[model samples]
Target: MKKLFILCVFLLAGCATQTPSKTPSACSEEQACTIGDQNTVETMQPLSFEEALSFFKEKKSGLLYFGFENCPWCQEALPILREEAKRQNVSIHSILTRDENNELLYTEEQKQEIIPYLQDYMSKNEEGELTLYVPLVVVVKDGKAIEGHVGTVDDHDAHARKMTEEEKQELQKKYEDMLAQLSS
Candidate 1:
């Protein structure tokens, strides 16, 4: 009985360990609010999955951005994302949820198929207005996925890995270039 009790304590300790926080300590409440309105900006007509998929196939070598309208980081990354996509000449898809604004993005046929994924693959909040925030980028060619993820955790872990000044500069340049392409 004593041995079993000690074993239970060890198991409990293992379960008690906390997941490392992925948010930066410097991320302020103000920044959180404006996360939707970032320094970088890019404009593009939103596309349906079918339209986006066709574009991806035509690009031959393309990047697919998987995200939703409600996620703040997804909004923050959009402009920078545009620059990078322009440089690489890839197609981007701002993902949609059936329960949210995605109503128009997908056909009635697709809702059942995608509903499960939107809820499971992305970080979902039951309350508040919904928006998908995970930053997912897939590089694909010839209908085959060349690089990307099939995992549940897709958001950037800048707090844990940390973003360097050099990386930020490079990202800024790329973002500017993408905006130019979209305008062109």
Candidate 2:
């Protein structure tokens, strides 16, 4: 009985030390690729948020998508960004919600630093400038706001048409519109 009690104590202590499990993949192929749209998102070019911001600052405009891995909408939105990047011949970087295995090469420190920047720039509301959403997007250029999504997913009518051709076109238009808003 004493040995069993000691084992239970050891197990409990180990459980306390364990980190939470990592989030799951956000996208499946069904949501990412489809046919027949000008806005089709079939591929992705990745860069960290900081790199994207630097590129955007130099280019005079940029788009940012902030989502975690385990989020369903985030999974859907990521492919849309990739498709847009590929069709447009651009690069899109993904900032993982949590990277326990270093798959995206995001260190704990880097992840900590990037999340704040994204939350501040992308999720801020207009009236209060405070955000309460997880999957958010922001369009910025020349230190100005263009278009921002507090919680809109990529599959949203504003950004995509789902896995259809028309949907692709819509997504493309939204991307261009967002850019125009930022660059103007």
Candidate 3:
């Protein structure tokens, strides 16, 4: 009995000391919200208009993510974006447009440059006005915008739904393929 007890304790200790895997899983809203700060992408600071233009001009191929801190979709999308970007070895730039309270954070000078760039990615309404959306991602290459995606590729009803591991893999693959196309 004494030997058995010791063995059990050793097994429990081994299990307890095992390291957790660093592989990312599909993130919940709670996890996503706190995973990283707003400057999680390659550019640690918010880019000025000239800086942003210069980045695209120099890099010629990279991912641009436009989001606000408080936007639910942005919160949900960012974690997935980070993981896939890292895996695919893509450089990502983040543009923050608002604060947690939905206050505008971009300067008018910044907006003057950013708005026109984003307008190129915007969808048109029947009235021919630009329809802008939050959590937008633009794939750029050779100083041209290749494609733009709006919103999270994962389920939008994130608060009420959780994706399975297979679903997460599929979403990651989709992003990988999209990025590959842009690079190619």
Candidate 4:
């Protein structure tokens, strides 16, 4: 009886000491092929363009980030975005701008279909054609894109290099500012 009690206590102690499991991330592929790196990839929930459209159609309020692993800017900004999202306790939905082969995920026709929904988030080029850029974060509320930010800081133009401390701070502030609007 004493041995049984000691065994039970040991088992209980072991269970108590074990770390609680974290919620499974929404990551799909073996890694975040679209976003890159397990850590950054795990922070976002991957959604199809159709799925994303449905959210907008349904007027669901959430954060949507568009980028792919191949995008240098995305590689640099995603980690920071993940950190900011965690700090704000927000979930981010991501879509792959390109496939593994670096091919565009959406056809021009498909893009045309969704252009109206995301027109505010996109920019027009010199040719006056709507262009969608990667590393774009859009805050959608009630089916309207209330706020959108593209790339990192204005000063850190190049994606090949890393952002300096000041740039990172500025970017964090930008993210915080953008995310703050979500609650409002």
Candidate 5:
């Protein structure tokens, strides 16, 4: 009986110490991909609120993109934003709601700080529902938001339509003009 008790204790201890597996995947089964067969972007995952804040502080004149890995609009906008960032030579900071492990990355306090900005920029749908959608792009200067866009610029319908090169260039120019105004 003593031997069996000792075995049970050892098993329980091992179970207690076991950590969750870290698999390398874009999204889990619970978090279905909404990108519609497109590849997801490889973005930096901030481990803590401080890290994300520091990124914003360091890149004072940049774009802060809030998104989820499983969001379809986010997936569509990322590549366009990447190209825009390169063309404009501007920094782009990605803030994710959850990590690849489906874990919450932002703390309550951090959400409080960020969500208001996203909320302020949200638009209403045809049904008059206040849409707090993902792929939110905020143009920031000195850690303050100057402008915010809820969806892909030029994809007004949010239907994930394929944008032509001309359309992409026009969108990039629009943001560049906005950033220029903020700088001035």
Candidate 6:
């Protein structure tokens, strides 16, 4: 009986000593509010605009996704991005383009600071002012933007509706090609 008890204790100890899960942290409350219940992507790590810009100034390599939770386009692209990141074994550093109040995520100074690096991907608005659109996935290597893809697909013009499976697959392929550029 004593030997059996010792064996049971050993089994319990072995179970208790198991390593932590590799899953990424759960979405923040704000993220949840933005993303809602359809979120399947768990690899998103939120970072400040300053930190994302530092990757450029410091010449670091990373995948940076700029989007807000309310954006249907962003919500659609996230799962694809997550899968591609997992497949490539890379971490995605995300930057919120807007807050819960629908305000800009960064200050004017921050916008100015990062504009030069992101100008190529930004679009011009009615006033000829540059606008940064959501779901902009940028792969930077040594701080240089190697590849950047904005939105899910070129054919899908509406954000109010979900993309077709074919479109999602196309987006997945786009992400795969983009993430393939990661050197570090």
- Each prediction's Cα lDDT score? 0.45, 0.50, 0.62, 0.78, 0.59, 0.78
Model 5 segments more than 4 A misplaced? 1-50, 53-61, 101-104, 116-119, 123-132, 154-160, 164-170, 181-183
Q: Compare candidates 2 and 6 on lDDT and give the better one.
A: 6
Mind sharing the TM-score for model 5? 0.54
Report the number of clashing residue pairs per model. Answer: 2, 12, 0, 0, 0, 0
In model 1, the Cα lDDT at residue 157 comes to 51
Structural similarity to truth (TM-score) of each candidate: 0.38, 0.42, 0.59, 0.76, 0.54, 0.78
Could you give me the TM-score of model 1 versus the true structure? 0.38
Order the numbered candidates by lDDT, best leading.
Answer: 6, 4, 3, 5, 2, 1
151: Cα error in model 4, Å: 0.9
Cα lDDT tens digits, model 4, 66-153, are 8887787887787788778877767788887787689987888878877887888788889999988878998999988888888887
Per-residue C-alpha lDDT of model 6 across residues 1-184, encoded as one tens digit per residue: 9999999999999999976534332245233211212333335667788888888999998888898877888878887788777666667788888877789978888988888999998888899988888889998988988889888897786556789999999999988888877853
For candidate 3, write residues 33-82 as lDDT tens digits.
Answer: 22233333322234444556676667566777777767777766666777
Task: Name the lDDT value of residue 163 in candidate 2.
Answer: 42
Candidate scoring better on lDDT of 5 and 6: 6
RMSD of 5: 12.7
Alpha-carbon error at 55 in model 5, in Å?
A: 6.3
Q: If ranked by TM-score, best first, what sequence of candidates would result?
A: 6, 4, 3, 5, 2, 1
**What are the per-model C-alpha RMSD values against the true structure?**
18.7, 15.5, 7.5, 5.7, 12.7, 5.9
Q: 1-184 in candidate 1: lDDT tens per residue?
A: 9999999999999888944323231222123211121322312334455644565456544445665555445545555665554454444544433224444545645544433333333344576423333555444455544454322223445445534556556555644443344334
Pick by lDDT: 2 or 5, better one: 5
Model 6 ranges off by over 4 Å: 1-26, 29-42
What's the C-alpha lDDT at position 97 in model 4? 77
